[model samples]
Target: MEQISSFFHSIGTFIHSKHQQGVYNTVCLAILLGLPVLIFLFSFFICCHCCCCSRQRKDSSSSGPAHGKKRKKKEEDLWISAQPKLLLLEKRASLLV
Candidate 1:
């Protein structure tokens, strides 16, 4: 147990070598400590971006023809007029027969 603890102490001492110790090194250590937080934030943003794209696709599908009320009205009118024209053609065909 003493050997194991001393091994860890030596490793710590090696890592904290005076030549490599400074404010910049401290900041680097702090940044390394926060690396997991940075990775989580990156993944969170990627998930949000994916969700946004899926929502956009759903909105586009739901809003497709309904978005242009004027165009829908025009199509309805064309169909209404076509029915009368079709009836007239049928009547002319009956008279010829």
Candidate 2:
């Protein structure tokens, strides 16, 4: 039992010594604390970038049709006038049937 206790004590002393003077503590602290902070900052910047891009798209689309695309009002008006005639023809054909 004494041998086992001495072995454990020596192991503990070695760990303590390493902890006090080695780079192990610094690396452990960075992994435990710095990693989470770095991840949070990265995610925040990515979210902001995505939101800005989407907002730009929404603003541009809301501004109306792109340049060089003109509205064809004359063709639209002709189609509008033809609708009633087409409806009349459909009704007459249904009556004959």
Candidate 3:
């Protein structure tokens, strides 16, 4: 029983001594202290970048076609103006079937 208790005590002492002045402890401490700072920096940059992009987009949108004429042409292209032809084609295809 005495030998077992001494063995456990020596193990505990060795673990404590090694941990107090060890590379493992130093690495763990560095990560624990640096991780939050790193995350904060990354998030700060991301938020700033997103806000800048949104602001630029909003400013461009508020400029009211001042940016270019391509958008207007694209919008015009999206409108369908041949409804009568489309209707005739549908009727003919249905009649043929």
Candidate 4:
């Protein structure tokens, strides 16, 4: 890391020296600054993509049957609970008729 930082420092010094003559120092500075930012962004996106893929795999494999079973059970319970209400309504209608 120290060597890499020293290398960049040398390059910055070189560009700074060249800046006085109005050369391509601005372009060099842009490239130097942009490269690390681009690399960081690329790595961040890759990590996010990998995490999302892993989560999707885990959820699909582990939650499918369990979630389906729970949903089906809930639907059945709702229907079962509604039966008495339907019976009461029918009795009321019969009494009214």
> Considering every candidate listed, which one attains the maximal lDDT?
3
Off by over 4 Å in 4: 1-20, 65-97
- Quote the positional error of residue 88 for candidate 1 in Å: 64
Q: Write the per-residue lDDT of candidate 4 for residues 8-53, one digit (tens) a residue.
A: 9998787777777675777787787899999999999999999999
List TM-score per model, in order.
Answer: 0.41, 0.44, 0.45, 0.45
Best-to-worst order by lDDT is 3, 2, 4, 1
| Model 3 spans with C-alpha error above 4 angstroms | 1-20, 64-97
Candidate 1: Cα lDDT at 53: 100
Looking at candidate 3, the ten consecutive residues that score lowest on lDDT are 67-76
Q: Which pairs, if any, clash in model 1?
A: none
How many clashes show up per model?
A: 0, 0, 0, 0
List of clashing residue pairs for candidate 2: none
Error of 2 at 51 (Å): 1.1
Q: Arrange candidates by TM-score, descending.
A: 3, 4, 2, 1
Clashes of 2: 0
Give the C-alpha miss distance for residue 43 in model 4, angstroms.
0.3
- The residue-by-residue lDDT of candidate 2 on 1-97, one tens digit each, is 9999999999777667767886977578558768899999999999999999999989998898777667886655335567788888888845564
